[model samples]
Target chain A: MQSTPPGLFRASWLVARKDLAIEFRTRTAFFSTLVFALLGLTIFFFAWDPTTVAAIDLAPGVLWAIFAFSGLLGLQRSFGVEQADRAMDALLAAPLDREAVYLGKAVANLLFVGGVQLVTIPALALFYNVPLAGIALPLAGVALLAAIGLVAVGTLFSSMAVNTRLAELLLPMLSLPFFLPIVVSASMTTARLLAGRPAAEAWPWLRILLAFDLVFGVACTLLFPFTVEE
Target chain B: MPQQPAGPVAASPDDPVVEAEALARQFGARRAVDGVSFVLRAGECLALFGPNGAGKTTLLRLLAGLLAPSSGHCRVAGLGIRDGKLARAHVGLVSHASMLYGALSARENVEFAAKLYGMPDPAGAARDALRSMRVLDRAEAPVRSLSRGLQQRVSIARAIVHSPHVLLCDEPYTGLDELGSAALTEALAERRDSGAALLLVTHNLGEGLALATQAAIMRRGSFVRHENRSGVDAGTYAMEYRELVTLDA
Candidate 1:
């Protein structure tokens, strides 16, 4: 007798757990992302004249910039693991709904991107000498909203580019277009929040991020099955 | 003993766990699978022999629902492969690749499959599958750390964990040694005896013939020869196969 499949939520969680477990074991992608993030921040800090332009102004742009690039590193490796032995075929052949695969992968990517942000935000504050005394929670809130948008689009493109000859190159090339709106909105929101401006001042940019997240989140989940279907 | 060809019957059996009707797939302008068709009922095994690029893998993929057929349809347990979730629940595939996570332990890999299939006790199911494949001792070892043969056993364990009704295997014997081959043969036979319909694609004629109740020789994108195993003369089949393959070449 054949077994029934788990519900979409359970199946997606299982996939996400499997992915995070593998990432935890190797630490290849996560470590590289950290190294790249820290290295990128150090260079950005020194490249500009902090004396000429306030460090506070550069912090928001620098944080989001580093976050975007480093998040790409994580996204590129997301579906790459499934290619190790064509383990993806087993996943595709399973009885679970295809959206579960997308949701699981996107959730794992969200956590991955979120983890990188957790470290990079503190590093940004230290290197750029940007004060975070009263705005840390709002800063984290903006980062979470931005990450949802990033993972939604990045995970979809990652799945599409994984089987190509130049996956590393193809992923960024395809995803950067979709990521532009996210980065712009996030940086704008962060700038307002970092300036200790009224929460109302940042609402418009936050709305853009929220809209991008909602639209792409549902669209990517629907489109993901087509990318994996051959 | 000599045997005669048992040609295609006018009608299918009452219960066919796997059925492919006029299935075809095209790549660019090339027809990888050109209108191939067959049926296997409960407890039946069909060993398909073909040369490289003869469309055997494409056919299997189409039936396994990995690749959508450009035209035609196939079914598992009377459910169309394109019928979605429930249909896939009835099928398992073991391809040339191990299809396993290298960083995951053998036990973890099997358990992952069980959980995806919604088994109530994934850990127990995984342990049972590992023990059955004779890899229980290495359950905690990372798959990448194990030998190729051991990894293949784990792959099989993962594929069978859900107790699928139709099993598809492509070049399953690729890297096995004497002992590994024996173990695989035993496992496959056990599955067949338990009423799972099977489609096995292999280049190893002797091994395939040993387990096949039905057999087919594929060339290009079509079946050049097909018959029941009882109708074949084991001693002469190798020579006949060589001639057929050479003629096609």
Candidate 2:
């Protein structure tokens, strides 16, 4: 008798878990992203004339810029990992729910991007000599929202890019257009929060980021099945 | 010994587990699968022989639901492959691609496949399948660390971890040496003996004919000839295939 396929949540969890297991084992993608983000920050540190520029003003954009670009490395690894042995063929051929695969992959990308951010945020704070003081929670909130948006579109484009011959060149070209809104909103929100502006001022950007997240999250989750389908 | 051409009636004792009726898949101005059809009974294996670009892999992909047929219908265990989940639930594929996570241990890779299929006992089933492929001793080794032949064995283990009712293989022995090839043949035989219907596409006449209950030679996306394996010996088949392939070329 044939076995039952896992439910959406379970299957998605399994996919995410499997990817995480492999990522943890190799740490190739994870550390590369971490190092890239740190390297970007170091460049931003020297590039910015902190004596003349407001550290708070420059730091937010620098942080988001680093996060956005470094996140691509993680997103690229999303489906690139599956290509190692064409393991994706097995995933596609299985009785798997395509959406489950997408959600799982997106979530896994979210975590990887999140991991890079977790370290990058504090490190950026230290490098730029900015204190989180009162806005750490909201800073993290903004980071989370921005990451959801990044992974939503990143996951979609990653699936598409990997199938194309120009995969390496194509992913950034494809995802950057969609990711700009998040980068802009994230940097804007972080700027306000870092500047000690009232929650009311940064609120709109957060809402925009949240909306971007929900819209792309649902759409990408639904559209991913077709993106990877043969 | 197998009897008669395997159309849709050979060994009707068990219902046909896989049925393809005039299945065709087209790509841009080309028809990759031009109206091929077959019925495979449980415990039956069909070894399809073809030259390069003969659509053998395309046909297997069509059945695996990786590609949809442009026309006609195909089903596994009475359910449509295009439909939600049933087709995938009963089918397993072992392609030339090992389809594994290189960073993952062999056991972990099989466990992942079992989990996707929602097996009742994923760990136990994974171990059992790995052991069956004779790679259980290396189960803890990362797949990348294993030899190509051992990796092939792990791929076989992963494909069969769920005990699928139907197996679709596309040149599974591409990188195997003699030992690897023997292990794969044994794995296919075990699946066949367990009443799983199999469709294997290969260029290895000796091995393909050895395990096939029915066999066919395909050219330009169509089956030119199909006959019972019982009466079709390898030497005659190799000669006929060479002549047909040359003429087509």
Candidate 3:
């Protein structure tokens, strides 16, 4: 019989790797997220007149909104496969820790959603003619931290919503409320960066994102077992 | 010939796999699992029998640490279900639902479970488990494409991947064909041989009688009768089970 290691991080990594491998093979999750994000960007680019509004002004809000919605798509599909085959019972039954499962899903969601953001950012820059040269690294960093918070709560709620009626509709309704703080902070920070504001000015939003990420991530890790239990 | 210990002989009285006292679960006004209590030792397969809504599933969930009791207390592997982190590692569950990822292959599903248990080399463990269940040939195939029987095999493989001490199965045989049932039976026997304490909730008396070393009958959130398999006949046990449930009404 195999024994679980005492460290929580190792278990979380394994879960993340497993989800990544599965996503790589199927491409179902990645492709849907990519298409959803691109479509959102396309609609926004055409909706407002470029002459009337500076594209840079709308860039941060549009980018984060697309990422948020796209991330939800990936998060929904992450657990969708587990629910389809009834594999959750098997996962719950394993001798491993529940915190491991939570962290695994969280890490997987971050990477999957982060991957979507990586793709969406360049596309948004190209379409809007905005220069991403200086802010790309910070933007990506902020996106990842914010994704952690969104995925943490989203993953927990998805487990519950998947078993209910109208899961597709229910998940967003349940998750969106919890996601407001993340969306606000991420958009505010990203907008300031895109507007060529000084780093010191954007630091407040960065701090909010950091604090939000830590509190929500830790809380979700603690609460996941209750949500997924039979 | 003397009866042999099926697997490892658990130490006596020092620890019980399961111990419950006045355990109960109430949903709204309804008492789903009410004032129930029992003890299960390692290397024992205890069959839980009841009609639908008889609270058999509820009791099984409570033991597995999947559901919390509204009143009273229960412990699994000396850990309380309320201690979700500690208790979950010692308890495992298999149910009518497969709980697998359709997009993932059988191997991936099992490997994912291994990883969740914090096992290193999840791929190696998954491969060995699938091979043991005779489903290794289809390990690379997506679960959505596998037959129901094969999917159940994957489910079984996934459950034991982490090697939990206590296994809780609720109607594991529900949609299985004869061959599938036979396969599941063999797999379960293997688990039992490993000294895992199994708590099974099933409507099939024959399967329960065949697998269980001990059996308990439940109705309306309580256990009315329980016995060792060698101590009762099938016909008599079923008749008594029906009588007990009806007696209360």
Candidate 4:
């Protein structure tokens, strides 16, 4: 009746393209996330007296904080879109691999959250007077690793929260606990990397971030079917 | 429309496209679908009528592969419901919800579905579906901007873009105006005439009675009455359906 279903990877790409196209056309998730990150940066900038604290000390926390919360905003919207008119019901009924849905959502969240950071990191660097010229490349590597863990767990939790009575309050509560470890590791590594510390010194923390990425990425992808089941 | 087929159709009965046996689905302490079974052959349209909490939705979901039966199994389009790929490929569902991306234009929404199913010419298929639904004039408009009636039309277009072997519609006529409802009736009739098996769940006896080759009434997760449409008296059945639907099981 139908052509053979595409491989899991190809199916995921289709789903990812759908989400990306929606986000691009509507700009709802994209602008909301960008604005949230920018607002958080401004508040933190004005709340603290830059004269008393050095930008190097402030830059690490500020960067990850912006990344995490803005990512939460994007993750929330990712599933929120599915809730409109129960669009998710149609998606679940489709014959594609269940894992493809999880992977597609994770990838979309990664790109959205990643896009916000790509802009915010540079802006924060300019405002905080932190010298990121030499380390921008390496710092990006750390951010990418940390993002994988956040998007993986966030996508799973968002799926769970949307089914609950109070999704607005529930998603952050369910996801924040999982997000803590990655944020901590990323912040510490970013702090060291910015301080001109040798790459070897930050390797241990990077390993922890890498492990979190691997563990949850695989676990969440496999667990998605159970969570999505009717 | 003819009367009921008289008995359960077998799994491989002369090209039986839909076959279910002892299908039961339980949710916590509630048995949503209890030991139900049926079969639908090509060109058959089975209209399911029931009250709220009668498990009609659950039954349709089970057949559409949207929900898994807890105890029994069924085959759709010659593949088990658990066979997500081939089973889903052969089915299309139109529910109260539009199940469309509100931000995307009507044409874009159907095209996305076509592409999702690996159709080679998504654009042309989308155009054909929209034209059939008579919303081709507004094809460029976003679904959110359209009226509820028009949105339902788009939903129908999206569901049938693949021309699936089985069409599952759960209250597809809900929220439609008089004209909209009439349009839906015609659309559904056309879909049935295309040789697709249909399982339409609704509270409207008149609408249900009109399109079904066989009609079934469900109560508390089981079918209490199923008869051939040709034998059913609409005026008398409507009166009985109203009374029976209001009574607590």
DockQ winner = 1
Q: Every model's DockQ, to 2 decimals? A: 0.54, 0.51, 0.47, 0.40
Q: After superposition, how far is residue B119 of candidate 4 from its true place, in Å?
A: 1.5
* Tens digits of per-residue lDDT for model 2, B1-249: 111111122245466788899999999999989999898888999999999999999999999998878998898877788886657878888998899999999999999999888887889889988988888999999999999889988999999888887889888898888877888899899889978889999998988988999999999999999888998978988999999999877
Question: What clash count goes with each model?
Answer: 0, 0, 9, 2
Question: Highest TM-score: which candidate?
Answer: 1
lDDT of 1 at A178: 87
| Clashing residue pairs in candidate 4 (N, C-alpha, C atoms within 3 angstroms) | B3-B228, B4-B228
TM-score, per-candidate, Cα-based: 0.96, 0.95, 0.87, 0.93
Quality class of the docking in candidate 3, CAPRI style: acceptable
RMSD of each: 4.9, 3.8, 4.1, 4.0
Which 10-residue span in candidate 4 chain B carries the lowest summed lDDT?
B1-10
Tell me chain A's TM-score in each of the predictions: 0.97, 0.97, 0.94, 0.97
In candidate 1, list every pair of residues with a backbone clash: none
Model 1 C-alpha lDDT per residue in residues B48-131, reported as the tens digit of each score: 998899999999889888899999899888788888787887788899999999999999999999888777678888887788
Task: Mark the regions of model 3 whose C-alpha exceeds 4 Å error after superposition.
Answer: A177-185, A223-226, B1-9, B13-15, B84-87, B118-125, B242-249
Task: DockQ winner between 2 and 4, please give it.
Answer: 2
Tell me model 3's lDDT, rounded to 2 decimals: 0.79
- The 10-residue segment of model 1 chain B with minimum total lDDT is B1-10
